[model samples]
Target: MKVMRLPGLAFILLLQGCNISAPAPGPDFPTSEMADIVFYNGTVITMNEDYPEGQAIAIKGKKILGVGTSLQALATANRTTQLIDLKGKTIMPGIVDAHTHVFNDRDRFGLDLPGAQELLFKNGITSLGNLFCTEEFVAEMRAFEPLLKVKTSLFLTKTFPCGEIQDSWYHGYPATRTPGEVLRINGIKITADGGTCGGMAVSEEFIPGTTGLGDLWHTQDEINAMVLEADKAGYQVAIHAIGDRAIEQAQNAIAYALDGRPNVLRHRIEHNSAIRPDLIPRYSEFGIIPVIFGWKKICDFYPRSPFYEAADFPYRTLIDYDPDLPVAWHGDDPYRGPVNPFIELHSMVTRTEVSETGALCTPPSWLAAQTIPVQTALKLMTLNAAYSLFRDDETGSLQTGKYADLIVLSANPLTIDPQDIHGIEVQLTMANGEIVYRLPASGL
Candidate 1:
């Protein structure tokens, strides 16, 4: 029940990143000569440049002991070790969702932390960014930390219903400073514009008939100060900007805060739903991460207006503009889409809607041109998302010395037909060497 709660254990592990030289096993690391788990006889997608694909992986305690051939992995296992034959299944790093509102409105969703864990884990999500947190929410997370199996990075809300920056809430939170903690505060979330219900700030009218340009919650000067203050205080800022005007304003503020240079802070423009072609380059120019919605294209959550002009949910344009651009995907769960990454992935790859109710919405013809390859969509959901949370080096990939966060799938996403991707199911989910969720044997 008490998982990896050793004194200074987490702090020592925090010292590691993407370039793991060697395993720094703790004094009480469960086993000294034998691995706790050895998964072999399966296709392993390490996602590491060193070992792009492997046949097996070994885990000692919470750290990945080694990643290589099936023989190499089995060498570390003993009779006592839990040696799992994957039976030709596919295993890869657990899906990391960079942005979601999983914890919000739990009552309406009939969910709690345990329920949230089951929901996320079943979908192969081991890590997430829970935006729009309040002090009360943070407190609830801390109290429920023991029950949390999914890693959470929170972005505290600066105002009521995601508006009006509040300086008082920015200070006095220490445990939230790191990335891989059960619950950590990565930064503050500010709603620069509205979404879904139509307050998105835009230069052109979205609703045709009315003179609706949408709403801008804060002026340029106001957002600039808010971002700069959070940046100086050493917090990543995630702003919810749904429209072109709001996107531009967020870019401008980020540019000013970072002195017009590429930023390492990873300040994000969440739900970059509607953007102009001209604003595409600013993501790479300012190093601002575009946290886009993958399923937005398929859903009629927002009307497909005539004034769209290749401006709504332009993920492909933003991604192809710069090879190094860090474009991440979000589901905005329990709000617009489900937490299932495949639903999002299906939308990104097919440019078609996979609704929660099993109904399909006809996508705009322009959406087809915006579809990305399966590989690109996976990165957006995993590594790129981890990078956005400043946790790429720590947990994104299944590299040696990193936490053993991985999942087993019924089928491989890489080899399957694009149309059949959404059908792939997560057979097993593991986080930090712990098997968090698993389906019945017959389910596979």
Candidate 2:
């Protein structure tokens, strides 16, 4: 071409690496001075009765320093502190997914899917309980701890390979590990029966193998030994029991393990989907927490089988039996449901059926009677989830001296329609006082 100048090309390359006209920096705060990040002009749901709907909050170094009116909170703010005006947005403690498979899937499929993480954070989820994971993955997660803002706890699953049956160890279980260490770990998650493939209702064929009537994973003797070993090691057993037979077996296991130990760590039956009405009281009597799936009755179970039609979901039956037994709703997500708690809440409150056929149906009576209040539901995700992991004192609520894990929502969940609850966006997510996710102005 017309004698392209080499100097011009070099200048263009240099310009690409540097901005010739840089914007002035924002006001800087002194590093030596005490720093506090304050948020004002927002409806703050404290979850605590003392301070409900406050105008401002002040946080410093992984803890909430104070929560009060805008003027009161401002008293602690100095020139060194950073300030944010929420413009009347709604703010609440970070959303917690009581039951999740984040780390499980991450380890299974080595991929960082931002969309999956964003789906949880953008919809108000800030903390998660990785209900099931391999010890190897947990060690790996501990290494990159800072980037994963969400609090995570590992629960060991006694699967075929990792567990010993008749002196033979399962494949996944490390051969070098001692039995004591394995039992000392959190819970052991074991699958009772195959879902969908096993008939909609519990039957002999549904049991592990074609034989139809025996222990699904291990013999009763082996299960008893495992449960007792775990119990002695200060571990609470969390079993995945979905069918009626599975529920009965799980209940029996808890009863056997806690025979003499009163008020032992609350054993949890994950996805208590099909329960005999008589067994409802067993959950409370034995200090077993039933983590029910809210989305199951409305969306998952209804379409898949006739069981939904045969019996009313028995939501009222369970709550009426044990009001204080710690019944919490959960979405066993990315498996069959969305990770959005609001979506689970909406379905629970309305009992609105969403079909795979794209048809919508509502139960005869508003399931609201059986549904726990929004505040209680919030606790299920936070306090209850933390309690499940035996880490309540360290996290769960937004309080002084606790980790500053929280999320800023776009709207007040209590005042808005339950259906619109899921629509609320997470404006900001902070874990340990560090901003992890900030929503763009466009709300993308």
User: In lDDT terms, which candidate is top?
Assistant: 1
TM-score result, candidate 1: 0.88
lDDT (0-100) at residue 332 of candidate 1?
Answer: 83
Q: Report the C-alpha displacement of residue 68, candidate 2, in angstroms.
A: 2.7
TM-score of 2: 0.76
Write candidate 2's Cα lDDT for 1-444 as tens digits. Answer: 212342343245335552212122112212232336877556667665444456666788877776555544444556567777666677677766656775556433344634455556666666665665556655666565635556554556664322333321222342221211211234555554334233222433322444343335545666667667666666666776665666777778878989956645667877776666667888887888887776644533323233323223565678767666667555666565455666666566556645445455565442334555667666666677666655555556665455666778777777888766656666788776777788888241
**Pairs of residues clashing in candidate 1:** 18-393, 176-185
Candidate 1 regions with alpha-carbon error over 4 angstroms: 1-33, 174-180, 196-198, 297-307, 360-362, 442-444
- Please report, in order, the local distance difference test score of every candidate based on alpha carbons: 0.78, 0.59
Question: TM-score, each model?
Answer: 0.88, 0.76
Displacement of the residue 154 alpha carbon in candidate 1, Å: 1.2
Q: Least accurate stretch of 10 residues (summed lDDT) in model 1? A: 18-27
